[model samples]
Target: MVSTPSPSAAPGAGAAAPVAGTGPARPRWRRRPGWIPAPPLRGRRRVPWATSAAVFVLQQAGTGFAAHNERAAEAVGPDGAARLLLTLGPLLLLARYRLPRTALFGTSAVTLAYLAAGYPYGPVLLGVVVAGFAALVAGYRYATWSALGMLWLGNLLVAHAFHRLLPPGGDPPGSWGTDLFMLVWMVALCTAGELARVRRAERERRQRETAEAERRRADEERLRIARELHDVLAHSISVINVQAGVGLALLDSDPAQARTALTTIKTASKEALGEVRQVLDTLRAPGDAPRAPAPGLDRLAELSEQAASVGLRVTTETEGAPVPLPPGADLAAFRVVQEALTNVVRHSGSRTALVRIRYGAVAMELLVDDEGPATGTGPTGGGNGLVGMRERAAAFGGTVEAGPRPGGGFRVLATIPLPPEEGGAPLQ
Candidate 1:
């Protein structure tokens, strides 16, 4: 009895063998042991509201202290109402991500009211900065800019009015230098917010493009696999079906012919299995060795021989000198020939088939004809073979035509183009 191999006996089985000096392989980015706990790897976490609260508290306290010491501006001193407004302004920022526009406009309005009431100018500006950034990130460009413009203009008017009211010996009020400084500060904030928004949008666009490319690659791979499977299975199964029928018919009267038919079926099935395995191996990891080269036009002789073994006499004729072809075009030419011959064996009911290849300056043409009567039926009963041939040709900027011959049988003709570098060569 045959025995199956054990897991350890399989190639590359068990644990990976150690390198001569490196022991087991370790990932380069693996974390080293340390006292500090590693950060959690969960996707982006929400910012804590306490952080915003802390910033607001510090800014208010510092600003309030600065305002209380200013002798020129008695209106700048903080009171119960100012403290309440400061607290509420930062609190609105906690929901900035979900309601960015609301938070931004609300905070801007609050800051304006606070300034108009003559409150100190410490951390109160932080609210407007944070809200503006949030609004920009949320894609409210026009509204954010409009709000900032109005606020800057209002600040200028308020500062000028307050400056005129200052006592002669009091601390100097808003000046040209201060106005320029505020303008620079607001511009810097808006510029930073705009840059950040642009960067984020670019990142998202790249991610979307990458996903679309991957999806297209997957679709192309699936189409390739389908074509390979259909070609391999259809050709081999067609041969096997014919041979099996012959074997059954001859089993009672001619044991020798029956044995030959059985042998042909076995050979065809084995070849089909090997080709299928090769196609499947393409799906493995990239580090694996490359698969064997796919069969091309050079293998047409073997294909014709296989058809001959199934009682179809397939004669191949070449009209031009051989020329190098791109892998896709080469493979497509071979498949067109293969599927045509398979049709002759399965549906034509004729003893002879003819295949002609013509190489030209810009394209290669294939013509397969049989002398059997036209039956309007294909191998699969729905003309899937013809559809497959057309698709394969179209992939290489080629075309296929399959129809009834004028006199008797069916014929298939295909023309596949050559790439620019390899075209226009004389027959050698």
Candidate 2:
């Protein structure tokens, strides 16, 4: 026989151990891509493409001032075949700095093309260095590091070549200061870009979590309202239907009873209206009240009296003082009992019902036993009535068990747990 595992048993025993080396979970964020954004319609998009494009073009023209004598940036002397590409080749190489990976490959190709044709008016090495910085910002860590390594090696080789080409000790220490400053500027810029990207990612993750929580809260509110409609409003309407029928049946011979039945109908309708208004208040703007709160357990005796007038002979027994419950909890318990009694009158087909309420130190129990067709008079075959009672009890950490009693009739036991006060729920 297969044995059931204990609650504390491991989830996966005698398994392959998840290929021997699985790791812990990552947080909700940090795994997400930084550049991917919510839909364009949801929020503003802030790609750095525009800024990069403009800055790259301006920097390419500006570099000419440092590379050569006062010559305007128009590349190809004056003009030749009016070639837009040939003339723009040196400047176009700045695309390496604007984009990320493969930056060095593009830069080196452009530099070789310029040199093969005759050296350009600008230094080719500048493109390669800017490409390295771009690669770093775009998360191409290995490629960026490799490019920077190659750049350092190339610079050392060029310094050696310059030493051989010029006179002894051609480059002086004064020039070293300019190279150092340029290296510092590149480092500061790339580091700042990476930091800003990380911060933006964090903000978006927080906002997404907040939005999800708001949606969950809205869904819960809708479910609570639906349950209230079933337990309270539906059962009240059932009561009104039976009372109205009784009133119409006796209208010709017993006009006085007909007036009483009409009064019961009006009262039940008003109570339902008030309950609906209370629910609406939550969605309304502050300080708005469509109606007062519905009557609860405090007014249940009055409820029994109304039912008794319509032939549901009810006797209520109170054991202890009523306890203080949450506002909604109090309302729910009252409605459950009211609905139970109403169902008894509509389907039971009997005359007498007993409502016995026991208020304990920590909880309250209500026993609403009735006689239907065979033993008592009330409702008969309603799906909503009994289900509503159970739902109300379940709402407040309680339970409800209902069925026909052996040798007798129908019985509904609704027990509600009170909030703990000292040792138990507070008594009123």
Q: Highest lDDT: which candidate?
A: 1
Runs with alpha carbons beyond 4 Å of true place in candidate 1 = 1-51, 72-75, 161-176, 287-289, 374-382, 425-428
Off by over 4 Å in 2: 1-42, 45-49, 68-198, 286-291, 373-395, 403-408, 425-428
TM-score, each model? Answer: 0.80, 0.63
Whole-model lDDT per candidate: 0.74, 0.57
Best by TM-score: 1
**How accurate locally is residue 377 in candidate 1, as Cα lDDT from 0 to 100?**
49
The 10-residue segment of model 1 with minimum total lDDT is 11-20
For 1-428, candidate 1 gives per-residue lDDT tens digits of 12211112111111111010113433556522211121132533354487678768886788767776776445556778888889888888887765677888888888878876676677788888888887776567777888788888877776776655533324345567867877788888888888877777777678779999999999988888888889988899988887777777778977887787789789999999999998888887545864778889989877876776677667778877778888778999999999888887777756678888887888889999998764444443347778889999998888999977878788999988877777853222
**Model 2 Cα lDDT, one tens digit per residue, 265-288:** 898888777777777776684356
Model 2 score (lDDT): 0.57
